[model samples]
Target: MSHQAIYRKFRPKIFDDVLGQEHVTKTLKNQILSDNIAHAYLFSGIRGTGKTSTAKIFARAVNCTNSHDGNPCNECEICKSILDETNMDVIEMDAASNNGVEDIRELRDKVKFLPVKSKYKVYIIDEVHMLSKGAFNALLKTLEEPPEHLLFILATTEPQKIPATILSRCQRFDLKRIKSSVIVENMEKICQEINVKYDEKALKLIAANSEGAMRDALSILDRCVSFNNEEVDYETVINLLGTVNYQVVMEAASSLMDKSIEKTMILVDDILNSGKELSFFLDELIICFRNMLIIKTTNSTDNLMRVSEDEAEALKNASSKISVDEIVNYIEDLSTAQLECKRSLNPRVLLETKLIKMLHGVNHTDIETLTKRIEELENIIKSGNVPVARQSAKAAPSRQTAVHNDFPAQETRKTVVSEHAVKQETSHDTSNSVQEPRNFENKSDEAIFNAIINGWQAILKKVRSENAGLQAIIRESKLTEVVNKKAVFEFDPKFTFHINAANQPKNRQKFKDVISSFVNDNCEVEFISKREKEEKSNKPKQTIEDIYEDLKNEFGEEIVEFKQED
Candidate 1:
């Protein structure tokens, strides 16, 4: 006999043999036992989740002559014929290849007749979503009112593409992706049955790489076995999949956590030299980081990493050195780099640049350190110990009362300003006459706007130095004005790229923070086109309570719980 792939060879012949789909199996079994079978059934989920296998098993179980407990007896003639694909009543069609209206019409015409021999005439259509619109319309009426003896089972990975009319007629059962732990357990059982020497770590690597697909995991295991001649090890599996070594990923993460760019780059270089794909390495790193995050945040191991207990403990230990925010940032960067690597002509260059950025990005600044520094500055400012030169100078009388002359209650404002100026100037000997008059006339608007423009220019320079594409777009952007604590930025129609970039929540928040720090105030920043009107009515005007409620809904209800802050 020719060699058969593991996935095909080990296809579930009975519902009990299906792994990681107990919900599906149990429900189908009860339906069969209670004689509540639907005329048309639709099975949907991610690929390799046993949608087709379950359909076949259902066909056999319903038609088997000598069936017990909702399971088919493989020894029966009907079961054997279906298994061999020679059953006259059970017809399997690939809708992907035969998707015309005529084909569906033919099936619809045939459904009016009774089964030739079996108890039920089963039509299994794989990838049913590929059927044409006319074909779907043709199938709709027949599927809704098929004969008592006729049954239809539609399977598709992309069920969303299927029209709602057809979907409403059939009973839908969404099969879930098989979990990694289930995949690992099943692989171990298969290895024991085949008498192959395999390590648990090798099984783990296969499961993780499978991405919750049982068939893919088994197929990978089949290749590993073929290469090693029945003795599968972790190194052999890694090499066969062209995956980065787990140790290498760990070392890279450790170096990043330690802020050792040199060590991380060396590890990256070694992986590249070995000809492993940078995209694949990034995917593996994401999984590694995900595992670390799970360990750090959750005390339970229910959905934790599907590795061995020892490996899980090791990940737990490693996760202790990094904060949750750092992990989130690292994953975000790697995920973005992975997406970019897919489109770049030189993936290696993109990968290297991203690694360098991850190792040295300003986002990596420790939050605890920043908070401590801010607290120290606040303490110094509170204690009246700041340098005398850093204090503000007094405002001149002309600039102070100029605005009041146009109104009437100007003396009161001037008196208040003079008192503040006296107190502020008493603490410092800085030049009060130089810029104080101009600032008093404008009341700090010009200074704030200049500071905002300077800060944005600096950020643009940094972005340009790192990413040329971003630089090309932001170069044409301009800062228009800062009014009512809102920084209004403008970009030309020729350079509309920053509009999309600024709309991203992360980028928007970063820009807002930078502008706020530059202006030295709790100001909001908004990016708008030059032609856009700054209508107060059109603004996103909302009370603080309303904003808090919206944020609570976005983040989670727990974020808004009342708490007394010290």
Candidate 2:
């Protein structure tokens, strides 16, 4: 029996064997069949998504005498020779090792020669990004006017590093990360063929830990098989991969959500003591909240969730106890903490500290709950069914007298019988009313306006951080007014492009979201040109946002980036 690793043993022999990359493979197969293949090709993606394997297959397909539907017939002598790494015509060069001007010069010297056996010569260069600048220049020279009989297939994980000149010459195929479901299906088929027993959950766990790399998945499965005597179980997969159970993380989240300090601390201790990495545990916690957020929103365990029935049920049950906003905020908080831990030397202490804060932290979700309750109360009051507080007849008269003495604070009005409303009610004697604005009696319109003015720099800095390009566009804008969770932004008329862009559906939503976080509630944003606001209000005031809508509307998504003339 062959003792090669599972990844090597199960490498795709044909186009159909490659999973989750039909977009790339199918296109290549079509090109091969149509004889429209480019002289230079770039295969770019994350590792182990079959960049090199596909290159080999394509090389063999091009050289095969008996090609069937653009796929190489393995039985053909040319295809079999390439498959067994004996074909000199199909050269596989590891650019990572031979990435020098001399190596490239040697390659250039050989390119003039015709194919030894096949109709065309193919050079498959893996890790093409590693080639030196001089080597890239030399390679560019060769590709500038390539021989009709030569093909260059370059594969790399970091395509950004490749020179743009080199990139422009090749037809680039972007490979995407294989989804967990696709990986699991392949794993199950492999397990059946190999006669290895495995829990489906175990296979899924391996796939998740592989992070979209098929080779990584196979390597993980190999480890699982080795540890579990070819009979892999869920627990064995967990232990081997050091992956924290979703249930365990869910329980910890439950403790945090419940604000059970002791329970949270105990769970943290148990997790750390069990030999799991704190960073990985943090990742699992982040993912737990992320999944909770998904389940909280979608309310279904569709393809989005990659878990078994038991884990799905557990996630749903845990998610039901919390609001979507809570899950989002918790995920954000955990992500921040994870970043902090990564930067800090004492990660364990940081993790423990973060967990403690999570236990007692004042939840933003609570603010949302209060907001909703206040809205409901307002609706009830507007309907003229204010829930009046019961008291003796004596107390009612005293309360009435107090209403006449002064304007009651906004906090006092939440009790439903506002002093202003009561005075108007006694005089007019009517329950019907227009919607009363919920403004803090102490917090005047002028006060809210001034607060926004004072915090303009902080707001601008926030926008700057979110998108530097946007900041460049909206450098001359500011908040002009804020009332009832609605913010008005004034911008100079000359920069109408910025306003139109900022007011577009997407940029407007982003701007509103940032303002909401700043104002601690949902906020609606309105954009007005300085001149327009002045013409309407008969006063001039300077402000803030877009190459937004007009350019987008006029140019479409292929943004024309212009450079200043020197």
Candidate 1 local lDDT, residue 384: 50
Q: List runs of model 2 lying over 4 Å from the truth.
A: 1-4, 299-301, 363-367, 373-566
Residue 399 deviation, candidate 2, in Å?
Answer: 30
| lDDT (tens digit, per residue) of candidate 1 on 192-287 | 878899998889889988878898898898888888866889999989999987778787778878867788788888988998988788887887
Cα RMSDs, all models: 14.2, 19.3
Which residue runs of candidate 1 sit more than 4 Å off their true CA positions? 1-4, 364-369, 388-566
> What is candidate 2's local distance difference test score?
0.74
TM-score of each: 0.69, 0.66
Tens-digit per-residue lDDT, 428-460, candidate 2: 111222223333333433344566677667877
